[model samples]
Target chain A: MSEIVDWVAVDWGTSNLRAWGIGPNGAVTFKKTSPKGMGKLAREEFPAALDELLDNVAPARSGPLDVLICGMAGARQGWLEAPYLEAPTDLRGLLDGAVRPTMPDPRIAPAILPGVCQKAGADNVMRGEETQLLGLAALTPGFSGVVCMPGTHSKWAQLSGTRIEQFSTAMTGEMFEVLRTHSVLRHSLTGDLDGPGRAEGFAAGAAAGLDHPEQLLGTLFQVRAGSLLSGRQPDWCAGYLSGLLVGTEIGSNRHLIGDQPVPLIGSPALSALYAQVLAMAGARGEPMDATAIVLAGLKAARSFAA
Target chain B: MSEIVDWVAVDWGTSNLRAWGIGPNGAVTFKKTSPKGMGKLAREEFPAALDELLDNVAPARSGPLDVLICGMAGARQGWLEAPYLEAPTDLRGLLDGAVRPTMPDPRIAPAILPGVCQKAGADNVMRGEETQLLGLAALTPGFSGVVCMPGTHSKWAQLSGTRIEQFSTAMTGEMFEVLRTHSVLRHSLTGDLDGPGRAEGFAAGAAAGLDHPEQLLGTLFQVRAGSLLSGRQPDWCAGYLSGLLVGTEIGSNRHLIGDQPVPLIGSPALSALYAQVLAMAGARGEPMDATAIVLAGLKAARSFAA
Candidate 1:
């Protein structure tokens, strides 16, 4: 029932995996997603997980069809460990160190793209986002600017032409999730997130985070205290905390970001939040379609066929 | 047997409760502890929990014996909500609005001291630490300076004579714990914390936190990356992270602390660590015995009894 496909492009992350079928004519058609990601599967279980997803929509070809994978699936503890490609190198070098995993089925060929790492200054690493960055580089020729990818571990990169000069990561998303779910602040952040006083609270928090980041740790308890002593609503508290964290991420890297617009490669909802914070700090955000960029990155890797 | 026992002082915190038996002569003779605290018991279960603890070391009395209490037991969610007393007031006023809970046992007389709140500039609140600050005042007459108490929710308070002018709370301990146990940093923070490279790692992290607080969120990823790419020891990561958080806490409040030697109150180990960080910041920390001060504060509260 599927159209003719030459290869499958997969973005396998810690929590989930998304796949796209690519035709030889550079057209992307078939699509599938599974919650089973690298985090869920062990070394031995990966083959079956991959096979299950591939068999669902893979076109029947006389020869073994190629499968290109990016993200945490290439992590050290994932399907197969792909060594990190050091930073300052153009992402085109990503395919040179890609790992080819031996599959049980003779009809499947898979290659895992290596993640990028920065050892000097501040040690940092990134996997799937590198592919997205590559896609950004591919989409806009000679693009030179700062890019922000918001996620569990929000990443910021400085790209000069095709080479990534340096990068840093903020524990913004992960910190927010953990603090909301596990900390005392959890008590004050319970209600419909989109309901009541949210905009005011987010604005107040974002301003504080962006202006006086030195007071970041000191002001966190105010989220709970405001709710308790001042009767600040739960929605307001949640929004405020989210804005505070996101704003802090942007503020901390404002020097690298400059006044120039930043390309935000992330989910629509999260990217919009970062865009809001950036605008507040005199900078702007240019929203790039995440799916389109990542697919482009995968297709770029496909061209280096053996 | 406790000699001439007259009343008992208890510090019932979130996770544990500690009791000190005081004689009519004002001598603290018996000390007992239990893991059951305000966090574990429901509203109805508080009485039984308190009864179980008091039933053990509480002295025999012909009439109802007074049980002086402070800390989370007086929290809105604790045994009984002792409403917070707004700041800029002497902590000796802690006893004025202390709640007297009607106990199940006729022989038990309980009074829970109210916590302090700063509602104007920054919404802030503290439960048991108010009593600790009261004790500090009682120990040093006319003591007017800053006090740093390290714990799950680290607190810093400014004292003018006996009055607590203002205070702030940091989620340092809680943040470190959650990140270590729940975040990706958990993978690299294993092995003995006292094993090796502890001091060097801590120093480096402390410097980073003290000199550049805005880089806090950006540099956290380095803890994990260091271990992965740079062969950082687990002890180093643990020590580094610990220093980073503690240093950030002190660095953020450096202006409030000024050139004055801050009083360090809490566990000896934790207080000593804070002292070390303070020393690095060109200030000094004076270690105050927590038990001695709490006993004095509770004894001070006991004087208000009818």
Candidate 2:
């Protein structure tokens, strides 16, 4: 028959909404995803969206159901503002900063976890990734080193045991998107990073970004110029743009890695790309499955709840 | 009686069309601009757009009007492909590479000037800016040193007398536009460069970019983090972004400038911004009027044509 839902774990980002139903044994019993992300929903619409997702799998309980969420859903403009928790924070206590939203359904108790913010030297923040970090800590007990989460906003964190000592964010994915779609470089890019010359282009771009990061502004224009002058194919241009941004991100944050192999947490494809670039930069990357980490993180966070 | 038009100088770019009526005495008799740019018009629509703009001001000439055009109008997909004049070439002969398009109205003899292209090292291209370089050469009479043209794609050219030895293009302005509009950093930006804390923010960003050009990808996220953590104002974030991009561009291209006073060419406001950054970098920026340079460049180009 149906497995009883112990709690629900949600990763609500700007462009997507994902929910996982956990069994009492801490195993994920059900998982669902929707395009109705935090970006798409208004404050009031959030409850209905969550309800729709949970309707089929939520266990019929007499009291309130525990729904734990991370990501943009906790941002200032999301369902309810969960002010950021400053960095140098212990991952074990991430759920302590979780704020509960006033819900119309008394049966649903939604607790949104606050993102981690870096206030010193370089200002930075991460919402959903903190959960993943917690999961990482659980998966590898007493883990200490740098963690790279590659995506639209790639985050690099320095962990001291179970505590995140510092972190930085790079708008690498967003920059690639905007340059690919909105800028003049659009004419030169084919949008297929796997096409011919892509690997070579990516390698070249990454090297350039790593060696001379200051030349990024100048380097970006080469995509269009290479097309016009050297007949550089569109796919290669796309690959080069990706490589350049990724390389720059890795190159700039090398200090955080400190000669240690970086733990890359993301989708396989994205993590592989980062791994490739990381290798080129004279470093190694340890890839980890993002979903597993998030589930583990959610389970850990749920254990601390009231 | 309407003033007779000897020839017309047109700067047709991706976003706007500007034309100046030049009399036989080489003086601008009339000037007008339109939203009908090269990007907006199809190949067949170009003649009509030109005719509409030329109407009521063609001087009722019996023969075809001589139209000297520069910019994207000479692009491969423009009215007709004008091809490109490979650089390390003299600016005086820019008209020699001009191509005449087939027109419905024989009354319109449009000779589109070719842009400059660099095939070596990092591939680079410039369309309308070649005219400005030509104009700069004409206005200064054997002007040398590096010339900086700030725009959507900022161009930096090393000119020895009338010949452009080498040049580079930076996607600074385009980067700023995309980051400001499409990225998450948008929330932190006010779209105002003159707001409180703007000057300090700009100076700080420029210094950071100059100091650690490699840190650009990491540096950009500070806008959002600063806003979330320190309540950084939107305007200050905008200024910081602008400064960071500009400083990165300047720092990377320092080799092109070589301790020479750089000539800044563009609208006063934009040139002034570049000037401020240049001053910060210990380089003097000599601002020149873009209109005068374009007119001069066009006149020089016309002098070479039959």
Report, for every candidate in turn, its global Cα lDDT versus the true structure: 0.86, 0.85
Candidate 1 whole-model C-alpha lDDT, 0 to 1: 0.86
Query: Model 1, which residues run further than 4 Å from truth?
Result: A56-64, A302-306, B1-3, B48-64, B304-306
- Give one digit per residue, the lDDT tens place, for model 1 in B1-306: 433468889999999999888876777777888998888989888778778766655455567888889999999988889988899888767788799898888778888999999887599999989888988988898889889999888999999867899889988898899889888899988888787688888888888888878778877788999998999999999988988988888888888877778999999999998999999999999888998888888987667444
lDDT of 2 by residue, B1-306 (tens): 454798899999998999999877777899999999988999999989998888876643577788999999989878888878888898778888999987787878989999998886668888999888888887887678999999888999988777888898888888889988888888887555577888888888888777777788889888888888887888788878888888888888776666667999988988998898888888889899898888888888887654
- Provide the RMSD of all predictions against the true structure, rounded to 1 decimal: 2.5, 2.9
TM-score per prediction, in order, is 0.94, 0.91
Question: lDDT of model 2 at residue A67?
Answer: 91
| Residue A141 displacement in candidate 1 (angstroms) | 1.8
- Per residue, candidate 1 scores C-alpha lDDT tens digits across A63-119 of 888889999998888999998989888787888889999999977898999999998
TM-scores of chain A across the candidates, in order, are 0.95, 0.94
